[model samples]
Target: MTLLAAVAVGLAVAFVSLGAYVTVRQQMYRNLDDSLKDRAVQAANNGVLTNYYNLQRISSDALGLSDIRVGVYLDSGQKVNAKLSPLPPMNATELAVARGTAPDGYSIETVGTPNSPHFRVVAVPARFCPREDDQACDDGETLQAALVVAQSLKPIDRTLHNLGIVLWAIGLLGVIGAALAGNAIAQSGLRPLARLTAAAESIARTEDLRPIPVTGSDEITRLAVAFNAMLAALARSQDRQRRLVGDAGHELRTPLTSIRTNLDLLAQADKRGGLRAEDRQQLLDDVRAQMDELTTLIGDLTELARDTPQVRDAELIELSNVVEDALLKVRRRASGVEWDVQLSPFPVWGDERLLGRAVTNLLDNAAKYSVPDDTAGHRTDGEPLGRVTVRLLDGVLTVTDSGPGIAEADLPHVFERFYRSSEARSRPGSGLGLAIVKHAAEQHGGMIYARNAPNAGAQFTLWLPHAATQSR
Candidate 1:
């Protein structure tokens, strides 16, 4: 495409330049012919033709003309006049002009001894000359004599040849310049498309939806904008799919584990001959707890799968109050563990149920990881007691726990579906808690991060954009 465009532009310029050159050359030739014709007319008007009888007497003394030849022919086709040089035969065109039937223009033809190039000018008399002297001549009256002036055209032809060469040279130079300019323009115009192609290929190979930079307001820039938008949309869709998979696994793990545990207990009871009432009661309680966990996990997963538009359309509420309520619920579940709660006014825009679920997950994570059997400021093994801290401030919710900190290797994977720390494998909680919190944070135009605190525990922070009413 670029090469074709360059060639097209170059040819157009060359054609225009050639046309102008031809026009100028034609005009110059016409002007030269007109000037020569006018000079001939003036010579004829000055009675130079009438003096042809005395041409030998004054031939060397004639001014302006280096050489002149004159011929006077009678209407009867007899030569009536002569000059120093012998006359050449009248060609067909010159004869027609002398007879007053040719158009008014000069004619070039070879004549005379050497047969060199020559120009001829013919003039007709107004009436018969001296056949009868004193009568008024009509417009169509045949002339008795016609004057013919001839000049050598060798010099003018030589000049025109040189001018033609010069004009051709200029035209050639113009064509060369046009080709160079066309090439430069083609390169400049196509560079953006080349970059766009490269960016598209890179995205296709890597599936990385990075934006391509646009540098102009041309059509190519608009194409780049559309390409980047498509990439962004693809990235968002892929992210949503990943979130869905993680949510599904996280939501199913707890129920599956509960069902497996209950089945194992039933198998052991069967191996004992007969099941006791107490054993039956304990099994029933376990089954109920597992069922409840399954129901809660399913509910959380369904909430996560719901589109954010529906959630965002819900009423706004104080995020701090939601955190406080979740902490109270967690305290009831972990009555033996010490609690450190800090609450401040922080509003958010989202469904209160979704927000509350997010807060519940964070609090639940902290409570689950808190020291299990600590009493009187120490564990049964004499280890220091651990505390769960829930903080809400500046539209940020954080939960920290003083227990065995998450391993460095596991910190990054904590929010992944079905991913639990090594110490958490034997714990009685599903791994979906933090994952749910992460999704909830994102749905609210926020993000969540988990890391080991500088002290001796793990910290989870959820940062959300402040609600519109809480802008101040």
Candidate 2:
């Protein structure tokens, strides 16, 4: 920027100075030419063309121009001021004017030396009639002559040289001043960018998500606003990361401790001669159950830990198909609980795999809650618990279980990660099922809500938009 500013200033100064110098020199030369031509004409009209006795006096005193010189020449090569000649020899232009072959002319002359002073010269044709005793010279043809005038150009040259020096000095100062101003402006503009860069670098080095303070509304301030928004998002993501890690660690510890205790017991029993088959089998079953619970918890954490899915790749699939698939799988796993399902054709844009996962989690949670405490009696169809009903219509899908409804106090936090109620703590499942359902619904631009049904059962309604919004 500074270089460009300097170049622009230099060009402007150069052009302006060059134009000024050329104009002043031309005007000066023009004024000098006019004076010299007028004086020469006056000397011719004053009989200096026919008589050359007072040529020097007429040029210096009569013209009041001491630096001016005058001469007269005829077509026959005769000079008026023959003895008092103060001008150079007539060149072709002056000779042509005297001989009536060319018009009046003006020219410049200088000595043969390289640094010789210059002179401004002019020649104009006139009648050179001399007085006689009986008559005056009347033949214009024979009286043809030219008045020649010359003026030294040293003063004009000196003035033009001084002007050139002055213009050069002024132009130099202007360019320097422009360069300095440009640098200052560039520095002022870049100071904010420097702060922004430093803040970004500090964040990169230390993982801080602090926002930069904003001042006036400008392009830089707008950029800072956008950067602050990005920092806010990063801070949110960082918080989610910490929470997921801490919760995952806490959830994994119980199963791991139980498994370790069971292993130690088995090891000690092996050292003290083998236990009874029944007791050994019971210990093995307990260990297996705890391992399965751990596996399930880990899987739920993994599913919940996935970042938002790419909604652009989602296909428009029938949501009922996903729900039906979930019901089929849940029925096989939960044999004691009866299933009541009603599906309708509901088109929605969503990822098939994610939607299916969400539906399956919903069904599994419903069936897990609906099963009777006495599983063998319910399997034999003796006083069976109510069925898990899944209904789908339009863009809404509802799964209701015939179990104790959610507590009023637990309703708000049902979808929170790793959140569990007092009653659900004794169940054999992770608490991330509803959270996953809520997340998947939101990813598809939908929502999930829980309510107590009229049958004293908990009902989860998952509503999906017809067109999924693009996810970040």
Candidate 3:
């Protein structure tokens, strides 16, 4: 930034200085040309180059023509040098003036050696005529000689040299000022970033998940706010991890204790000279049931413990096929219950196994909560028995069950891992099924929302983008 500013300042100063110098140099030359024209006019009228010579010899400064050279170029090929100082050799322009081919104005010429001095000169036409008694030369006569007046440009050169020095000094100062200002600005602008870096480094070193203060409304401030939000999310995730571990431990203990007690009872019976056949088989069955519950709990815990869903070799597959497969598995378990499955040909991209599991869990949940009636018109819940409705339209798959809906208090936490409400505590589940469905939905970039149906039961709506194939 500082370098850029310095470059910009230098360029601006260079342009301004160049323009000013050119203007001043042109004006100085104009002044010099005016002085030369005035002197040439005087010399032309006087005709006595001798008087000007004597005047210059005494004091050119007193005559207001310091270092001003005078000369005459006669048309008859006679030449006279100025007495004030030797002027540069006459060239084509001077010759033309004497020959009456060029007008009188100003011309610059190099005098003497190769590294010669330069002079500004002007020529005025001189008429060759006999002077009258009053000493005024005839103006309308034939041209005789040309008066050439010249002056040294050393003073103007010196003035411009001094101006160049001053301009360069000013430019240098401006560049330095710009550099200083640029440094100050860069420091001020990067202060927030420095703070952010320090905070991040501190977190890396200490592993703290504390939110940072957001102080401004700029992009940097927005970044800080986002950082704070990330910290907050990390805190919440850690808290959830702690709670999940505690809940998993508590859930595992129950089945483990039951299995241990059943095994101990069997061991005692074997030590007492073998137990009755029926009692031993019942004890073995109880142990098997506890083991099965343990296995299911462990499986659900493993599924929930995965940080990300296992979606290996995912591809575009027919979603309806996956749903049909899940329905086939669930229909046997829910054979006694009414099944109202409406499958549609929806195509989506995801792992077939994971998607199938999610669909099966939803069906199982509906089947588990449903209390089937002996009569088709009556339910134990005193509500008319209705079938679980599954439909796929566009990209949305809705599963609505005619069972006890979620309570208002437990609605928000139904999808949370291991979160079982009081009403659902007696149900045979690890409470990870809904969480798995939720994870699958999120991994597929879809949404799952549960709301109670208006007449009865609950409706689970899953919206997956691009689930249905586009119509050609």
**CA lDDT of every candidate:** 0.67, 0.79, 0.75
- Candidate 3 or 2, higher TM-score: 3
Q: lDDT by residue for model 3 over 265-306, one digit each (tens)? A: 888878988889998898888888788878877877777677
**Candidate 2 lDDT over residue span 268-361, tens digit each:** 9999997789999999999999999898788778877776654557787888888888878877778777778788888888788889989999
Show where candidate 1 strays beyond 4 Å. Answer: 1-274, 307-310, 373-385, 469-472
lDDT of 1: 0.67
* Candidate 1 lDDT for residue 307: 43
lDDT of 3: 0.75
Model 3 TM-score relative to the real fold: 0.74
| Residue ranges of candidate 3 with Cα displaced over 4 Å | 1-19, 26-65, 70-80, 89-114, 120-150, 178-196, 214-223, 263-314, 349-353, 372-386, 467-472
lDDT of 1 by residue, 391-438 (tens): 778877778888778888997898875577778877756666777787
Ranking by lDDT: 2, 3, 1
- Candidates 1 and 3: which is better by TM-score? 3
Clashing pairs in 3: none
Look at candidate 2 and give me any clashing residue pairs: none
User: Which pairs in model 1 have colliding backbones?
Assistant: none
Best by TM-score: 3
